[model samples]
Target: MTDLDAALSDINASAEEDVYVPFEAPEQSELDQKINQYFEGVVVRKDLVKAVRGNAVVPGYVLEYLLGQYAASDDEATIQEGIDTVRSILAEHYVHRNMHMAVKSLIREKGRFRVIDRVTVSLNEKDDVYEASFENLQITKVVIDPDTVKANEKLLVGGVWCICDIEYVHNDSPGSVPWQLGSLKAIQIAGVDFDSYYQGRRSFSTDEWIDLLVQSIGLNPEQFTSRGKLIALTRLVPFVERNYNLVELGPKGTGKSHTFSEFSPNGALISGGEVTVAKLFVNNASGKIGLVGYWDCVAFDEFAANRKTDQNLVNIMKNYMANKVFNRGNIQLGAEASMAFIGNTSHTVPHMLKNSDLFDELPDSYRDSAWLDRIHHYIPGWEVSPIRSEMFSDGYGFVVDYLAEVLRSKRSEDFSDKYKAYFTLDSTVSTRDQDGIRKTFSGLMKLIHPNGEATEDEVRDLLEYSIEGRKRVKDQILRIDATMRDSPVRFRYSDQAGTWHEVTTVEERQYPQLYPRSWNAEAADASGSDLETYAPPIVNPDAASSRSVRSVAPPLPIVPQGGGAAVIPDDDEPLFEGIRDFKAGQKGVSYENLLLPYLVGATKIQIIDPYVRAWHQGRNLGDLIGLLALAKDPADEIEVTLVTGETDKPHQKHDQLLMLKSLKDAADAVGVVLRISLDNAKHDRSIATDQGWRILLGKGLDIWEKPSNPIADARQEFRQIKSDTTFTYARIPVS
Candidate 1:
């Protein structure tokens, strides 16, 4: 075992309860391991059988019944024997309907046998009888006396779970019609008492609870990295929060719906298109309550596409989401149901941010401000990539049913006050606007920092991210409805005199460079009268010639063709040469090597780039910091300033500040003295580090492709570099 595994094992072993086990490979494949893990320790035999089947599209309880008859064991031999026995039972007595003769023969020969099937029932009170029906047997109108019905009411009826027995009663003569009398055994099958189980395990720490949950899902936590575990845990937040609406829009095959549908009885997951007003709210005709009234959380699967939703339904849903109540033919009912809307996105994050805001392709009705306002949090689904086989955990976690209750009960506690003393919102922000934002911010804080002792920087980060989520909703609504006024959402420092600033969505302030023409207003303004007065585009003949030439040309002679020998330019001035044909480690041409000369004694550097406002932009600065760390400095402090646009809002400013903080922290750790500043100047791509060191840049910060997979390698990759791929730097200086 690795050091991490050994450490985890030691921790688990020391726990009050057995929380983890050393990684052990099952005799079967990984798929089999999952099945065994789900069923091995469960008390119910039927559940074991169903888990082994692994989602074959059968009624869950029916599979459970089969599992109960077989495979309820930790022993491999017994499980194999049970599997064979269960298969034999299915082949012998279970009717497939297509094989009519086989079913008839089994009924006749077996005389009396138990078969798992769907059954329908109708009460015939007038006749003092109850009629039982079976689909597979093609049997209907079988009657049971009152006493027998009471005893066997739980038998299968149509799609419901029930237990019944058929008795053939001969009437008066041989060859006469035979009457079948079936007895109802029971009405509803009881699920495991999850509430009691949850209460029993409530005292476990969050990490312990997560481990138990992972084990309940039949995954080995060891297979997943810490970050992977956190991502998976984030999926559980919806279950833990009451009336908490969560939307996860990421790439497909991420197991987004697995926890809701398979892990708990309190949750329900329906297809995105299947949702209707009546199904979600109340049935007007019969007063039959819908999913929202029954399930704690109803997740809408595949809820992303713009074209696949009903406009009218979306309107009613908007109100339902906001008030937690819906109107159905004048009858109103309140519900505490939390909604989860999960979907798949076709475009990358940067691409989507450039084209439109995060909620760009949502249906018209769902795009309403009233509805979007109710959504507490917006998970950056794209940040969560598709699930791989390696991401599952081998560690133990709580059964989801238990965790759901913990979150529901903890709803009464508030954590927003944790930041009240340290920071505040800009005065222009309203209370109504802060409700949703603060609630979500507080909920996350409670989950992560329950004691309310989070540091100032941590509080600031969560607050900014939380505000950005709400801002995404509000901004999109403004685009849809011109009448909607902009909400003043900003964060401020309570102790500082002038720290308050307006918050803006990352898409609105930082994505212009990647998609310059997509912003409707900005594009319109630039395309109008401003174009004529704007400066003309500059071109370099040397750059143009380099693109056209296929082979390298020899250097020209010092002597001119019609004059005295030309004087070679002095190399004293640092010449910023943009590495057109640059590759890493070509003698002294790497990024690290190039920056060493400037660090020694160079002064007065200028960097011009338009896309350096985002998190990725901060990474470029980080890289420069690393290069500077290599320079020899004991008594000297290098002063570096940046030239870039001011971010459109305070949140962007916050992001920039955080980026600088990281740099500062790293520099301090290594004892490096560096000072950096930002400047707003319009110019072509170039940088002048120190006097006379000039570099002409191509593509500026908008070069390089985003890495396809971040977890694969460390170096020469975007993830390893700790910055966005939206930047490339070159050196240049004035002659």
Candidate 2:
């Protein structure tokens, strides 16, 4: 076995003993007791599929079902035996469609045999019995009992891929056929006692419960930060609620459809093929219900690529997605299946919003404003990074089948009204708008707080997330449809007797050009004169803006310093803590980010770097002056002294003079004095200010890599680091 295979097999082993594990295990604590008590026999650890799934190209649920049958015990030896048993079963009994004759002969010889295959049941009105058909096996007209047919109505409409026993008997009587069902089992959860499940859920904290749910879906939640965790969990909304419609579009390899397709049996993940009205809604001539009537969730994978889509289908979809009811002939029909559309976008978030909108990724046929408005939530898939092996969980989580049942059982409960107790949303839009927010909120609550024991803060977090998700759809709809520009949907809410709180979508905050004239747009820019005049309305940057330290710099705390446009009351005031470290490939790094915070009130500043001698290096020095230009403090006559080693080249003196001349011109334009001197002995690099803050740099002014020309490609404000390097920043008190 490979290292990953060995590590996966040893997931149940003690952490110390299992040195091959690539990721950290979650803190089990008291939760393990609940995991063992209620979930022992019914569920299996999700990672076991990786342990035993070697060459078999089967779905995650397939491997999980086998593991559930064998390794459902807690004992190490028993689990190991069960793993081996499951592996053996897949190798021997699992049908290979390519070798159909061999499997058919085995079934005929054995009289009855179990095999994994897709089975769809149909009602025979003339015979008054249900007949089962196997897609891969090419078998049809096999009689299934009426009781089994009634118990699993999902089989009658959309064919379910299942594992069942196939029996063959040779009848002596004329016109008698012999293929019959010995037993049958649907791929999804048979049933779940939610009371017991809720009792078990109350054992863990909100964060712990959230992590457990993420792990149950086969992800290591710790790898994702809080925003990332929220984004990943939003994909599960469709499975937990009825008639929900969600869209996720971004770069590829983000596991956008993994949750819908292979994770559960109740969901159908289809490709972006030509969608006909009959295949999706109903076959009018045959009077058979389509996928919407049977499956709990139907996801359209690569949704943007369906160029040949019929306009009729889009029109029908728009109506059905909004009302959750459609007509087949004259018969009115309603179904509860949720809809998920996952696709890859060709343009970046900034690029799309500047020219068009995020919805531009879809083909023109399906980009109708009416069709787009029907969607309730728009998950920001661009925020999610591509899946890596380290993101896989090696901890205990529920088997996919078991979790599917739990989420489906939660559909009956509505948590939409639960938010009304703590907060009130603006009644600005039509019922459709309110329904969109409430359903998204309900779905998120069902996913994260199925037990209904969430704290007020936790509830608020989910509420904001739900609102932001729905806000993305609404904002984009306004861009697509001219009528929606005047729509009365306010992205604001209020707490009990508190001021109204407005929310902003992630992309809207990241690329403000899309929403150029927001109510708080001017307040977002916190630099120079703007900072002196206005303070940001929201304390938390994420409320409307993105990360607290993103493109929009926070107002520099004006304290007493000798010189600079900024001011403070007194020098005796205690200095507040200010320090930041940046990883490579990090964007939004500039001098305004590194030095501006420390040099706010300094009359004199020192720049020391040994290698600021080459032309590109001098250009970096010039860029530093440009940052000062952006900080244009006409009131403060600041003096900047550059101390660096001489360039050892023959014309070093001439080069140094020319570089200093350029720096002088740039600084003088910004109302500052620039001075330069050579120090051959200088080794370390740092910037010290008269205000008593030392900003140390491991790589000095050359912390960034060379940008290949055109400037826009390497603009550090939006550019990612191209190489691996280290830098440290610290502020020391001048005593």
Best by lDDT: 2
TM-score of each: 0.51, 0.67
Rate residue 562 of model 1 by lDDT. 59
lDDT of 2: 0.71
Candidate 2 local Cα displacement, residue 515, angstroms: 3.2
In order of listing, the candidates' clash counts read 54, 1
Error of 1 at 372 (Å): 1.9
On residues 52-153, what C-alpha lDDT tens digit does candidate 1 reach at each position? 443233343344445444544556576567656655655554555676455555555755545544565557557656677666766676765656544443
**TM-score, model 1 to reference:** 0.51
lDDT of 2 by residue, 321-368 (tens): 988887899878998999999898755565466567789889897788
